[model samples]
Target: MRISALAAEAGLPVATVKYYLREGLLQPGTATSATQASYDEHHLRRLRLVRALTGPVGLSVQQARSVLQLVDEPGDDLYSTLGRAVGALPPDGAEPAGADDPYPRARAALEALGQVYDPEFAAVAQLEGALAAADDAGMPITPERLARYGSAAADLAAYDLERMPPEPHAAVEYTVLGTALYEPVLLALRRLAHQDAAVRRLGREA
Candidate 1:
């Protein structure tokens, strides 16, 4: 297929596809002539992945490139590649909270749950930010509530990761895409569950 076909099949505009090509987000096709190139299924799959990353995943082009780079050149281990891919998903420019403040709270929360995690992990920072905001709002997540949420999250993670492919590239792709796509489902389910619980407890619409 040609670039136009590739774009059409990927449900994108030709100009957008050209832009991706120019930005090095999409790989060049096999040169058939000075003005023409032939693409294959590999290109189609890559194009779709690029669209998913930039569109639904809400990553900047640069961030998508970073993730694609990892997919193209997975490092020595799947675990590290996955960690880096996850680390790359969040938009850049999140200034770390002061070391002493959020770290202690976040670390303690994780410790209370017996979670073995890197204190410096991006998610730990995210958790710290959430905790700090809740504290400021006077609706702090108590230890019991934290433990409940932590247990549910752990179970969800297990269910998600168990289905991931063993291959490094596929595993990274699955992790990134699943994280992006399934988060909304989780949030919706949580809200729905709250509604159901309210109806049960209050005996009225909630």
Candidate 2:
């Protein structure tokens, strides 16, 4: 396929695709002519992944490029690498999580929760602290409850990746699926926690 066809298939603009090629995010397709490059399904797939990372995830092109490099590198452990990368991100509700300063938003969220539900808030804080300590010890996110999350997530992500016709498109599909899936799962867990607390309170009164 030509560049235009690749861009259309990926639902990206031609210039954006060219920009990715220039930035080394997307490898060049075959050089059909001095001015024309022919792309294949692999290029289309990569472009989709790049868009998802840079678009919704708010990853800078450089950050996405580094991640892509890690994913593509042979013999790299994908799960461990991804765990490290995500653990390095600031706690939830933090803005510009990269800055060295404390995450005021996350702090505020905790403070608000602490006001209304001290025990629950304390539990969440302990969990967060434990996860941080584990990360510092070079452990993956091994909280069994948290690790069990992958069971629900893996199938959805696999389905999305499989939906992409060409095998190479799996990369792009996985990126978008992760971005789309995690948020709802987190929210659902929060709701479940609240429900559990309510049920426990009712049982105590009974």
Candidate 3:
């Protein structure tokens, strides 16, 4: 397809496609002449994925680039590819915490959860970073509570992984897309559950 047709097929503006090409988000089309190029189906698919990541998934250009780079690298197992995708997100912007941070105590709390986790994982860093932030705000969470949350989150992950398809790339795509899209859905459900609990425990007879 020509650039115009490629943009039309991808539901993107021609200028935007060119911008993505220049930004390395989209590959350059096949050179057909001095001023003409032809894109293919792969480019179309990639453009859509790029839009999805930047649009609903809310990744910045650099972050999306990292995720796409991981996707482009073949030979990663589905699980590791998904990890790379999630890890590309910017951290919580709190100061970088180390293995021995007294404030959040997240490392100790995570250890107490009884699961071996990579301390270097970006998600772990963000979690522990948020814990440190909470501690700094004078609302330190007890290890017991952190354990509860961690266990529940593990359960959620299990459910997610168990339901994934067997195809490796499909599994990777589903994991990345589901994790980004369903977080708010999960939070909303939690909020509703909280409301129900509140009413059950504290509501007056009416």
Clashes of each: 0, 0, 0
> Model 1, residue 2: displacement in angstroms?
1.7
Q: What is the lDDT of candidate 1?
A: 0.85
Write down the TM-score of every candidate.
0.91, 0.51, 0.75
lDDT of 2 by residue, 120-205 (tens): 22233444455556568987464354436545555655675555443332343444346444666778987999889988887655
Local lDDT at 111 for model 3 = 75
| Highest-TM-score candidate | 1
Q: Best by lDDT, which number?
A: 1
Give candidate 2's whole-model lDDT: 0.60
Greater-lDDT candidate between 1 and 2: 1
In TM-score terms, candidate 3 sits at 0.75
Q: What are the lDDT figures for the candidates, one per model? A: 0.85, 0.60, 0.79
- lDDT of candidate 3 at residue 202, scale 0 to 100: 100
Q: Where does model 2 exceed 4 Å of error?
A: 74-79, 85-181, 184-206
